[model samples]
Target: MTWQSHLIVMPIVLPLVTAAVLLLFDERNRRLKMAINVISVVLQIAIAIELMIMAIEKAPEPMVYLIGDWPAPFGIVLVLDRLAALMLVLTSVLGLASLSFALANWYKASPNFHTIFQLLLMGLNGAFLTGDLFNLFVFFEVMLAASYGLALHGSGVARVKAGMHYIVINLVASSLFLIGVSLIYGVTGTLNMADLAQRIPDVAAQDRMLLETGAAILGIAFLIKAGMWPLNFWLTPTYSAAAAPVAAIFAVMTKVGIYVLLRLSPLMFGISSGASYGFGNHWLYFGGMVTLTFGLIGVVASQAMGRLASYSILVSSGTLLAAIGSGNTAMTAAALFYMVSSTLTIAAFFLLIELVERGQDAAANVLAVTMEAYGDEEDEEEEEEVGTLLPATLAVLGLCFAICAILLIGLPPFSGFIAKFVILSAILNGNHIAPNTAAGIDPSSWVLVGLILLSGLSALIAMTRTGIRTFWASLEGNVPRVLVREIVPVGALLLVCLSLTFAAGPVMRYMEATAHYLHTPEQYIQSVINTPRVGGKTENGK
Candidate 1:
């Protein structure tokens, strides 16, 4: 009931209101719409940061806001914990960067671009904050609907083709989401997440299998969104085909699935859930390893930068899923750090691809691949000028490209390297195993470690090859006419990654606390169920 509790809802409401206001303006008033959109997103970032600080200070206990002044297990609620707050801030930052980039040119692609963009943010913030299973489904649909428009924003042959596939795949996922929700609701008689967590352990034996069946179906739906191996065939092409800014924001869409898994898996199926303990974990583990391996292959085989960036997203997702499946507190914390670092890097890479590809012929990639496959056959008369100075714009692009490569490859002196190192150390040290046990580390742990290292090496090769073709091989290529507006967003994203590198200690501490909190489901369930409604009335009216 405090004033600060009200801030939890603004992230969702502000964008919803802004999108409605945007609809009132004529398409010709693009500058006005863009200005409004930018201001709204900036306010969201401010609000998200404030919420994050509050969540940190509050630690362990979540801030719950009840809708309609109704108590838990009966009414809608928004829960803001350390993890949810972190996601809110991440989503807001990515939104601002992507929107800024779009304003430069891509916004002109459609009259409703700004409108759809705000809706997407609304859906993302809602999904992150909602405490009810049904509301989560609602938000998922909203996010997917908005993404459909954004994917086809430019409406080229490739974009449309990929957009259709994206639409179809998500539609199927949404259907599965609904069916799973219905099954769980029927078995448990509750749709509120906290309520379900409290009720899960008490479900009758006859209904245990049914409950898990529903949960498994639900997991499959989320895995599809997370771009897990076989379910992810549609991902690379669809992401590669999206408009630059749209694709940049879509980077976080996959994480939405990961976030839900991080929240629900522990809360509903942890050690406390008698027969259901550790359900679906092995699937996540093996699936993640395969996804990582497939992504590494894609990264090395990709001929286009867009596809390469898309594959890198799969790599990030696979790593997170595997770490989560391990169920190690230290590994989960490290994965959270890696999640933030990789998301920002991939988003920046998507935006940067637009700038780097500008003024280049479409056949350039093909030609570069061909030369590598066969020969360039350059004439001796066409002597290369080895000492020529690079243009300032090209130099800047090259530098940004190199930084992205380092981040993606998990090389030293960056957050990516720190995250990977923490994960590897956590696994190798057997932190998850009991101190008194004689058993060694799990073999699956070794497989995960190998996959992570090999993925990094593959990424290094792919990025280096792409960079040489983009910056060095095409010496005569025209320097792109980059705009300050466009370049600034990319710079801002990379700067945040660099900030993460320098501030790894504090960030890792926060993530560790979050992971610990997640492992303790009792605290979360108590906080949610015990939160009193307005006027100091309990759900039981005591």
Candidate 2:
């Protein structure tokens, strides 16, 4: 109705509209399509920033919108809180970066690269904005559908094979998502997230089990999307096979899963007897810890650059899950902080990999592919500086390693440190819980201490290896120095991480606010439940 509402909706709508516009352009006009994509992304970024300001300056409660004037519970509800706004901002910026990354390779690769990329961004924004059960499901499908197309945009054998498996797996997961929602609705009699949050707590104990069953099913679906541990088989390779831009932004695909997990963790399954496995928080932490550990080992153990970056993404993801599972409010907060950090850093990493590959014709020189593309010599040799890379190239790589090392290892002077510190402290101090409750973890203080210490060691070892190979040791491969196209996105992400490191005070304050908003959904639920201006009628307003 007002500007704020309009702004909140624009992020989703702009991308959808942009995708259609992009599609209408002559596919042969690759530059035109990319221009449209960049324009759409930049506009979306502006809208996200505006929404963030509004979110901070306006009232504390989320900005709620009911589609078609339908009452809150009966109609679809969209919410914009610090958390959602934060996500939109992060994804929008990263989306733009990825767009640029992909642009370099898209000109010759596919006619519809620009169109598909916009659609992917559209789905992600919609997924973040939708506050209804079915809406969330729809957005997930929207994103995956576009992803299925973009996943194979290059149409190579490797891309097709990996993309197909990625599709089939997510397809099954999608079906499971719908089934879970169907069951949830069959029991709770509502699809609105805010409404369900209230209703699920009140269902008859017998019927509540049905809700629990549905929630479990839904959890599995999200974990599959999040690429959590065992179900992540389809992830690394799909990413590795994708072109640079696609790979960079594709990293955010799991954000959809983590977003749902974080959203529902607070809303759908708040502090209830239904809180099992630490309300999924315990699993998140332990799973994340293992993921990080394994990822570190994978990176150290792997030679392929693409595969190595893929492993890094996995490690980044595990860090978030571990933070969540730790069951410390502060730890969860840290996980949230890390979520943003990991995404940007990894996106930068992938983009840089692409640039380096393109410039040096690494695939041509090292992998034996032939290419004089980009006017760079295939066998050109560049002088190496000891204990440092080419100034520009090494700086970018250094930034990547620095951010990843600090964040993953939970080192100090960065948001990662702040986040990990908060989580570790929360884990060690032992928050109060019900007597003899499962929430009462075993030897948590010491166990968490050990894990944190172990994580630190692993992070050190992993970073040491990577730093030695990429920066310290003479780069075995003669990749060209960073290209201008590559510099913007990677540089943008690296700078943001560095900024986060210095602005810990403000960032932590924001994170704490976000955590409070998530933990206490009373305000959110009440905002929607008490809403009555929908469908020009008084309905579902208890």
Candidate 3:
């Protein structure tokens, strides 16, 4: 009833309402639609920031909103904890940036761009806020439905082909999602995440295998969404073919899978799940390693900046998966930090890629020919001040590109480096392991270390090569004609990542507190299940 109670649902409702209003207008009203879309997104960002502040100030008690004043387990509830609030903030900011980039002209590419865009945000926010498994599935479908439209927006052959693949794969994933939830509900008699957490330990011995089986199948669906290893082949192509703004917003899509795993893994299968404690940890660890390795290979082999950015998403996903699977509270906390940094950095890169590549191919070809013809004499050309102050347009693109490279490669004086350092330090210092568990660093942790370093190195090589070809080697090209709208979004995204570097202390503190709550889910479970019916009248009283 109070305004504060409404905060939990505003993120989902605002977008949904705005979207409905926009759909009333015809394609001829593009300006009106965009104006509405931009204002809605800006407001959502403000709301998300306030909710995050509330979550932090309130600590472990999540803000829960019951729809229609219904009781928990009987009606839908939206919960906003530290984790959910953090995700909401990320989603809102990404939506704002992507929409701004689209305003430069991508919105006109499709009649339904604004509609689908708002629906996508609604789904994303809903997925983060929902407190039950069934609603999670509903939100997944909503998000995927919008994504199908966005992926196919431009109507190019490549876009259509890639979108088709994306659709088919996700359709199958959705089916598995439903089947898995059905199995879990069939045995547990509950779909509420908190209720499931409470009941998992009490599952009959005969049904334990069935429960694990269902969870495994469910995880497969999540992993596919997260773009994990062998299942992720569709991601790079799809992302590479999408419109720039679509690709940019999609940087958070894979993170949705990571979010579910982080949320449910701890709440349902944490230290409380009896023999099922830490279930699927090994799968996550090994799968993440393979995914990270595959992503690094893809990055190195990618000739196009779009494909490289796509692979970077995979690397980001794998890093988080591995961190979560590590079962180390500190490591998970650091991964949370890294997730925000990587997602924002990659989103900026996606938008920048299109701008940087504009009118560049001709110059690249000419430079290549010049190099081949000059052969040994090319050293003289290379020695010329490659860093000579660039033109304004090129200068902005080059600076953004350089920052992306630094972030992706986990280089110094940036949030990316700080994040990676936190993870490595947690591992080396044995923050999560007992002395008896390992003499020094566990071999698994060592493998993680090697993978982290090697992947960063590979990413550095790939991004550096692309940057030189696109910016440095393309010096002969005309200055890219980037609009202020496009530049502002990309710059804002990069600045957010930069700000993370300065705010690392407070951010890490928040992450540590979040990780603490995750590993100890008693409060979360109790708070949700013990919640009274919203109205004074219970079913009997009514």
Candidate 4:
């Protein structure tokens, strides 16, 4: 295959390779690791951009590579479809921004930080790109294992306990994932998703229900990973405890699980034969709805700034999955759009939080310095300092209030608005499912959609209330010095949100087409099975 024939491999390969090289070096070499980190991140971003361009130009043909040159249905395949490509792009953007922020605020001397970070990226990239189910599990493990370290990056009692729970719960979920895979292999005789896509329908009807049960179990595993519902008890505390940069990157982890669900749900469940999801899509639709509502409620009630923001992100995931489980192209596309928008918004928010927290620290230090110099401030001087300090930070908090409001409420001129527009249109009009859903009583998919609208409004109100209290109501202190490192990350997020207003057409189109591919696994199977090459080179030939 020509080099361009497999551009998708670069994102995964570069990070893993860099991690390997970094692992061999001493932890004290901060300068070298930082250089490698910057370089690898830059490359990942470049490759992602290239793949997106290729996807747009090539249309429906995705870039897939068979490891060791084995053909599809037998060998492990790495696919770079629109969804996969989008993930690669989003992952790197988050990674880059977080890395810069960490540089500004974290202890640069920590030996393990660079190695673990690279591995985390490796897991994320692999999880997004892998086509084999077992491989997906493998990548998930790889990522979460690395995540355990990052979660406790700056060791403390709170972080340790939170990370332990986070680790233990995920391990249980991973075990369940393995169980699901075992049951699937036992029933279908294949772990290759494309092959299983064809074989599951042909299984004996006696075992048909069992196959779906396994699929549902598998869906539960991914949902658990996605931080949906009761199984997600570990999310808020874990996210809140991690370092700012780690939290920023961790925001996208749930999305990877959703990406897997979006890829597999249509094949596993639905109206088609051989589907694995049992009791129909209603299970997912309703389950996702509950989680969305619960998550948003939690977001509103929570106060520690990081935890509140993290819960809001979780709520976004639930809403997105609910849209997909509605089982329609329009709905799925809307979900993907929201996925992209939410990722950007959350990353931006967390980075700003770091800046806010840092500024607070700086202001505290400055106050100490002033007090030392003044030999204790007189009441009038204290009053004057209080007045000045409060206004400046209030302005920064005002910025946070505006951005989080846009994300939490799905407000417009932002990307969230674009996503909401598409979803509401799909929900209100009903999708292809409505004509078929009426077979059962009360099959309105729109009922599930209410989960999104109401939660979104609640998140808005809640975030707005917090903003009013923190920024508009009264200020306890002054705004601190902004982190030079984070300014760019925050700037990038707001700018992208602004730009998304204009890029809505193209973004929505890509998402729609991606949803089209996911809804019809036939294209995925055929694309892999029939792809040809010169001298067994494995060219796309799509």
Q: lDDT scores for all predictions?
A: 0.91, 0.74, 0.89, 0.76
Error of 3 at 334 (Å): 0.3
Indicate the worst ten consecutive residues by lDDT in candidate 4.
Answer: 381-390
Give one digit per residue, the lDDT tens place, for model 3 in 1-542: 66887878899889999999998999989889889999999999999999999998877877677788776787898888999999999999999999999999898887878989999999999999999999999999999999999999887899999999999999999999999999999999999999899899999999999999999999999999999888998999999999999999999999999999999888888988988998998889778888998888888888778889999999898888888787888888999999999999999999998898775665565566466457535345434554566788888888988999999999989999999999888777644422215456667778888999998999989987777767766655678788998899999999999999999999999999999988898888877877776566766987
Model 2 regions lying over 4 Å from their true place: 272-286, 358-413, 430-445, 470-477, 534-542
Give the alpha carbon lDDT tens digit for every residue of 350-440 in model 2.
7776655554444434432112124436567879566633666666666665666666566776565666666666665545221124665
Question: Where does candidate 3 stray beyond 4 Å?
Answer: 362-389, 431-438, 537-542
Model 4 lDDT, residue 269, Cα: 55
1-542, model 4: which lDDT tens digit per residue?
66886677777788889988888778668778888988999889999889878876765766668877777778888877888888888999889988887877574625668878989999999998888898999899999999998888886899999999998888888988988888888898888877777777688988877777777778788888787787778888888888888888998998887888887877555345543443446666667777887788887777556877888877887777677667778888888888888888887887777666653443544454355447654556433433433465457556765876786588776787777778877776656444334454234555655666777777776776656544543334446576556677777766777777798888788888888878877767777766554347425743
Overlapping backbone residue pairs in candidate 3 total 0
Report the C-alpha displacement of residue 93, candidate 1, in angstroms: 0.3
Q: What local lDDT does model 2 show for residue 438?
A: 67
Best prediction by lDDT: 1
Backbone Cα, N, C clashes tallied per candidate: 0, 11, 0, 5
Error of 2 at 402 (Å): 5.5
Q: Which tens-of-lDDT digit does each residue in 1-542 have in candidate 1?
A: 57988999999999999999999999889899999999999999999999999999888898889888788989899999999999999999999999999988999987799999999999999999999999999899999999999999986899999999999999999988988998999999999999999899999999999999999989989999999989998999999999999999999999999999999999998889888887888788788899999999999999899999999999999999888887778878999999999999999999999999996887766777898999868756766677978899999889899999999999989888998999898888745422213576677777888999999999999999999888988834789999998899999999999999899989999999999999887888988898887876547977
Candidate 1 is scored at a TM of 0.97
Model 4 residue 471 distance off true place after TM-score fit, in angstroms: 2.7
Q: What lDDT score goes with residue 320 in model 2?
A: 67
